[model samples]
Target chain A: MSQAVADRQETEERQTVGGRFARLMDMGDGALAFWLLLPTAVLLLAIIVYPVCRLIYTSFLSLSLTSGLPASFAGLQNYRDMFADPVFWSSFWNTVIITVVTVPGALVVGMALALIANIPFRQRWAFRLALLVPWALPLAFCGLIFAWFFQSDYGIVNDVLRRLGLPTVIWFNSYAWATVAICLTTIWKTSSFMALIILAGLQTIPRSLYEAAEIDGAGRVRQFFEITLPLLRPAIAVALIFRTITALQTFDIPYTMTRGGPGTSTVTLAMYIRQNTVDFLDLGYGSALAVAMFALSMIVTVFYLRMIRRGA
Target chain B: MKYGKTVLLALAGAVSMLPLQNASAETLHVFMHSYDMNLWQAVFDKYEASHKGIDIKVTVGGNTSEQQAQYLNTQMSAKDSTLDIINLDVVRPAQFAAAKWIMPLNDDLDGGTKYLDRYLSAYSKANVIDGEVAALPSRADAMMLFYRKDLLKKYDIDPPKTWSELSADAKKIQKQEGGDLQGLSFQGAAIEGAVCTFLLPYWSTGHTLVDKDGKLTFDMDAAVDSLKLWKGFVDDGVAPKNVAEIATDDTRQDFQRGAAIFAVEWPYAWNHFQNDADTAVKDKVGIVALPAVEGGKSATCLGGWQWGVSAYSNHKKDAVELTKYLASREVSKYIAIHGSLLPTFEDLYTDADVTKAVPWFADLLPVVQSAHARPVTPRYNEVSNAIRTTVNAVLAGQTSPEQGASQMQARLQRILR
Candidate 1:
């Protein structure tokens, strides 16, 4: 009997405390909003803000695993070393090149595929399913598949070229062709995702606009240029921003296909960071590299936001 | 009230059973690469079957040594205690010992130096650090020349002992075969094998990459000659035009499929050639020490795996016991017969069962005895990268041999100093 009474008293006390907190939240709308967002703010701090701060802090130290020396403060030394390193410059340029080439390449391919899929057909679900397949494939798997396809001796591309009475190209051995191959693969893997996003934008365009344009004698090409392109700007912007960010961080495809070979010509900044942190076990230098990558991403994202705001 | 009491009693029972279950079977986790997982799993199962109340859990790692090292290094650096035993590549024991990630095994073994006499001297020496045994050799490997025995006999040519003769023989065979048959296939890609590829010819010039003290003692002219020799093969149509893209497995695949007349590969390819279902070169393959540079001695690179007990393992004593069993001559002979993995023990090389399984093991003793290890230093990865990238660059026609050698020297000097 005494245990039952104690449990009831504890339950009532908890209810009263919760009720008091709820009443306190009801004092103002601003306070209610703050209370509602506290959990998310706490989570974001724990996951993102804490790690970023640690990364920045570690970047200012000299922590080399192979050296067998204790870590010591070395302000700006890693950054100084990075600026003087030729490999860093080369990898940075390669990352920029990947972003510049693949983003526009995917956009064009994706636009065509999106328009094709938007056509009214009875079996439209099949077309939609096909669009999802490549987008759903793993990046590393795509890299491996394309690597086999582009192999010098027995690759299907060279085989086809041989059958066509053309000279076959060595895909992965040459710097120019290796970069082209990885860029081509990145476009192929990512274009379908862009297509899916644009398809959603295509659905929002009312049929009445196309109908009015058709009645006004506007050709298919003209209507597409004016109406479709104009109406799809927002979706394209979103896809471009997302794709550009990912392109700057490209690692898996090139890693699987070339492993940053041919004299490290295809190495991206992310791969350089991996080589430093994981391969060489130079945490301080790798953290600095990461901070540079983070800054690059932030600048690119901010530029896109500004452009979007201005366009709006 | 009665229901609540019963629920509490049930929770207490479940909590108490956890310790009982743990006490019944002590689990030891062993991590190794996926390539040897099945064969090693059999050994683990044998150990588990013999030892009651002990459960052995195996974790398979990546395909490449570099990949496995990266994964293990990350885990060990974080002091992860989950992995009780680790299999390290031959090049990594020194680095792991320097970092104190692996425990010294002298205390566990019976005055460990006594047991060292059972294995090949070079491999056994690789595990000893500061008069303490840091690891025990599990298997041994070395680069060798793999040729089509049928083709050599058809041409009435003996296995070439010099690089020029080998090249001449390869070109002659290519001319005779006459239809898209590549003369040679070797790993020229920027990877771990490329380091051995660079070191093979360089070592033939009677130069050690690093002195016994782990100090750089590189010979630039010899390095240039080594670079030029590999580049010449590609340039003169002796090797594939895109040989720069070929990795270790690529050469293995090419040789196994009979696409190449000669290949430089590890001993593992011998097993595949003799046994694999898809091999076209079955009963047609021959192995020899890699061809020497003219007027220089023949040398091949040493490679093997080792067993190390993790410093962070809670069950260190049990892990060392398991390591001993795995490294025993009995287990080594079983692996030699079953998996065709070269045993580290000298007697196993001459064991009747092993010799019957791998007939060439009788001649392999000299090669294994003289094989050179890569530069043993904590900065070995950087050293390896420097050499491999230079080799790749020279082979890909991106840099001249002279330029690549100088560049490699500059990079290695900076790293080593």
Candidate 2:
């Protein structure tokens, strides 16, 4: 009976020590998590939340530099004026067109490039590196180069077309074509980013699945649809989200190449905001437009997440 | 021990604060747009040589007028005393003046009249907003026609003296000396350059985009006729369709590459055209005034910068002195030699050395003497942007001149009100 009691006491002591050690480990993990997250939280609040809140507050007020005072409360007048402004509507439509045209187009081209780069070829590495060149180049520089290439009088593209006995089309003068040209520039500049993302997803797919598909008599096209695409859902969602958000905010290319020109056909929402705030010195209206843009981007994010979840 | 530690910490804090305090003293800061930095550098060099005790620091702010205005507004709103002097564009003086972000030189300074007498009367008057000289004109520039003399000689045609005659001549040259060479080229880009260089002809033709009362006045028959003439140039293959998107640099390169017989450009291109290493048409180029418009006189659009002392600046007096010195004829002539800036001073325009150095200035001086400033208003930037947008719309055929003009008028009315 004495030996039995001693063994039970020893077992209880071991159990107590193990339980205390587990609690201490848990506390350490909690501390580590707090340390890791504090900087990010502070940074987000400083860089993002504060600026957004300030912008929102500014939007509700009539601010003028000449007045030399804090912006006066103007209620919803700025928002009301925005809706009634035709230029705003035109720019809104242009932003929509750019988003619609560039997002899906970039995704498809990017996926195609990712697939080609994934394949076993002699020049696969070279092709992959070359694909990144456009995205790596500065947007302004690319715009300048494209401007030269599209010159109606002496641009190389026109020269080549003329040599082939084709009618030279002015790329920027025609209202419809200028938008297309801008969209093309956006696609060329951003597709490599999508490809890089999709390529990473492609790498994550198991080799065994393709082997199994081949054993099941699945053709290359069938394999792609069955094995590759279904597995690439997460990547596609991420890429589409990224590309859509960026495409909606397309400014530098159109601003540099077209300046929303040929009658504001290429003026995106961001361009309109810049013009109102900077060119016209209408800060109240510009802030309202910025708020609208932020709201639209948020709505797009929510819609994308819902669609992504449903697809998954 | 605790007291000793506290003392060390306090000493460290004081050391750190010392640099900040010293940074606040002795330096006079100036802000200017990127393109004007060359002229500013020369002026600063001269000022530094003259003022031994004071230091001048300069910052190049932005590339576009809009960018510059926005940056200045933000800095001034923040009450940044470091921004001591600002270089504003001539068209934008009223906007800055209305805000009172800049000092009124006429009230604060002596010898203002003598300084004012050196500039062209129109330019000097344009800087006067609300009965104060808000800024002083530093440099002046205007657009002129640059033609390939050899090409004209080869085609056996005279340089065009009128828009109609120019159109005819352009077509004749295009037909006779056939290659990829266009008869004429100008900025058609949907930027301010297009409105300045391209639409000035239309305005010169007795068409005004905005009336003196600030109403949209772009839909007159003369304006439509002007648009049709521009379109005809494109249609007849005298001007390229892509000219609508050409930038200033792109247009310059096209002219340099011998792609066009005539180029409508600013005086900045004269040095490039004269330098044999930089241009193919070095000796073959000739400069002339823009052709007259039908039933109206030829008008050149004024392009230049003005110097203003910032209200936020603690060194306002020094800034004013610097501006006055920069605007003096001696400094203006030095700038003309070093930076190729067209002298804003009338005396410098007549200087024999300047005439010899930039012979084209002899032709451009008369043009500048009669150059037209864009409407002088506090909202000139907005007005100019609206004009550019409307003209671009008309040129692109997205909207008729009437519709665009009407829309612009409506927008301007709202802005004015």
Q: Which candidate gets the maximum lDDT versus the true structure?
A: 1
TM-score of each model, paired residue for residue: 0.85, 0.79
Off by over 4 Å in 2: A1-53, A64-70, A114-169, A188-220, A226-228, A278-281, A309-312, B1-50, B54-80, B111-118, B146-161, B205-219, B248-261, B275-288, B333-366, B393-404
Which segments of candidate 1 are over 4 A away from where they belong?
A1-37, A65-70, A118-129, A202-231, B1-27, B34-57, B112-118, B275-284, B333-340, B346-359, B397-403, B410-414
Q: Against the true two-chain complex, what DockQ does each candidate achieve? A: 0.45, 0.33
lDDT of 2 by residue, A174-252 (tens): 6687787777888888889999999999999999999998999999999999999999999999999988888778788
Error of 1 at A99 (Å): 0.8
Measured as a fraction from 0 to 1, the native contacts recovered by model 2 come to 0.59
* Residue range A192-248, candidate 1, lDDT tens digits: 989999999999999999999999999999999989999999999999999999999
**Shift of residue A223 alpha carbon in model 1, Å:** 4.5
Fraction of the true interface contacts (Cα pairs closer than 8 Å across chains) found in each model: 0.59, 0.59
Model 1 chain B worst lDDT window (10 residues): B109-118
Restricted to chain B, the TM-score per model reads 0.95, 0.87
**Tens-place lDDT digits, model 1, residues B1-417:** 999999999999999998888669889999998886688889989999998777999887788988898888789889999999999999988888877889999878886767787889988889997777989999998899999999999999999999999899999999998987888899998889999999999999999988988789989999999999999999879998888878999999999999998999998888899889999999999999999999999999999999999999999989999999988988989988888788898888888889998888889989999999988887778888888988887888877899989989977886787
- What are the clashing pairs of model 2? B188-B244
